[model samples]
Target: MTSNIGSPAETTQPVGISPYLSKRIFTLQFTSTPRGARLARRLVAVRLDEWGVPYGTEAHETTVLVAAELAANAVRHGHVPGRDFHLSLRVTAELARIEVSDTRAERVPPRPGRLPEPELAEGGRGLLLVERLAERWGWCPRLGAPGKTVWAECALT
Candidate 1:
């Protein structure tokens, strides 16, 4: 029921917020640099732990791998020099939704196709991995912004 998205910790916010106004959307944003991408992945692992999904568990492993690939794609393909990528891990007891948004508005995502063999090429298959692991995966134009967000959901049981 708390977040530190692009600001100070929620508990530090005035200390008398209406319960209805307190948000639970925890977002962690980082630069679109490779290091930031890497941090996104690591933070997911740590955040998952904080959320009671321990590292090395089946679900945590799956989610972190998904985060790594998607974050990597954001850095490699979605970067604009002055813009940063955004990562959000929203949980609601039943599911964990992971989103990575980047600031290259001109680029649209490709629909799924036959996956290239990782052995046969130097690239491709990132989304294929997502599709195979995540319960569902898709993308959307960034609402109120010039970028797009690629999102995937992993069920929590």
Candidate 2:
């Protein structure tokens, strides 16, 4: 039930989740470019549709916005030429977890409530939006990789 949503044709098949859990997982790798960021967001919407979360619902909309902001940050701040960013989404009955990993471990976003003042010329409010919309959000170093994954969890209810 994937929606067109301008999803790029480059997406791969969704990975299967662990057998012990009642969860669905969707994972994809994208070029570290603005176009890739947009594709990530659009595919998120499509994936939500496949997961029974209709478009325009709060859950679907929140997850899409989080995907977009995190992907945008990956392209704008964590991009490594010739390297790609990764997006993984895990949806369970209770919540949806969104993880966006980029190859710049040193460029982690500032902790929530610690962001610098908002400026008209400088754009840094993405995390703030994530903070407000996500049930909880944070980041960690990408295991076995020289990078970090910023993650956000949103409640389905």
Candidate 3:
């Protein structure tokens, strides 16, 4: 449940500053569980609101949904016993970026442009939803860690 909020330089910005004129970053580590996933989703909404996106705006909802899907996937697929997942959110003048890093490196998601075949099963559609909602999404090796980071970016304007 630990969280850090700041700018790229790790300095806190004034609350009333225009979101478009400055960059904001929020990073948190959560246990790889369903409850953790839910918390991540909720916190994302709260953070976006504080950044001036507001609760009911399309940008806010889309970013929160992207966070939920990424967090759930980290718990369901990339989880390792005793390891926690990480969520990093960055909002700029034109886009909101969401990154979820997990400790299981071998379970990388499908590539950015390729969509998995739709299955009739009850699961496995999370990435499809991400694809439709995000301007772009992808995964890469977790920097300085033994895992991968899956990320998505949603347009704010």
Candidate 4:
């Protein structure tokens, strides 16, 4: 039932009790590798475009960048041998969320708003960028899974 990156299959589901407020969801699993991370980013862009955000809009660009950062982190830090990372994109009338889940439970990302000092290192600032670009970002244990899900939310206007 999994869809390919070139043509991501979207499932529309109601987000709340109000029937007027519906959300579109796209979910896919990719290998925990650099190539898979890149594919995740590209697929996110495509899915957003299909969802009416288009390709060059600010909302589209911001969401795509956030997805790229999360995917990269999943590949670099949360990767587990032979386990694939999961990407989920959910878009509503006012918000778009990007979630990247990996199979490494012990390597949860730092809490949001308490970002590490930028002067401490030359690298490892992906989450910092995510925080700056995303309206809000955070991580939590994945339900029914063995790892964590790092999510970034962008306001759609």
lDDT of 1: 0.77
Q: What are the clash counts of all predictions, listed in order?
A: 0, 0, 0, 0
Q: Who wins the lDDT comparison?
A: 3
lDDT of 1 by residue, 90-150 (tens): 6655577889998887885665445465687467778888988888888889988889999
Query: Model 3 segments beyond 4 Å from truth?
Result: 4-19, 120-122
**Model 2, backbone clash pairs (residues 3+ apart or across chains), number:** 0
The predicted structure with the larger TM-score, 1 or 2, is 2
TM per candidate comes to 0.79, 0.83, 0.89, 0.87
Better of 1 and 4 by lDDT: 4
Cα lDDT of model 2 by residue, 58-157, tens digit: 8889889988999999999999998899988887777889998989988888776676666642677898888889999988899889999999999987
The TM-score of predicted model 2 comes to: 0.83
Question: Over the stretch 91-144, how does candidate 3's per-residue lDDT look in tens digits?
Answer: 887999999999998888779767656774356899999999999999999999
Write down the lDDT of every candidate, Cα atoms only: 0.77, 0.82, 0.88, 0.86
Query: What is the per-residue lDDT of model 4 for residues 1-157, given as tens digits with 9 covering 90 to 100?
Result: 1353324223644345442377788888998899999999998898788768899999999999999999999999999998999999888878999989998999887799777788974578899899999999999999998999999999988
User: Which residue pairs clash in candidate 4?
Assistant: none
In terms of lDDT, the poorest run of 10 residues in model 1 is 6-15
lDDT of model 2 at position 120:
44
RMSD of each: 5.2, 6.1, 2.6, 3.8
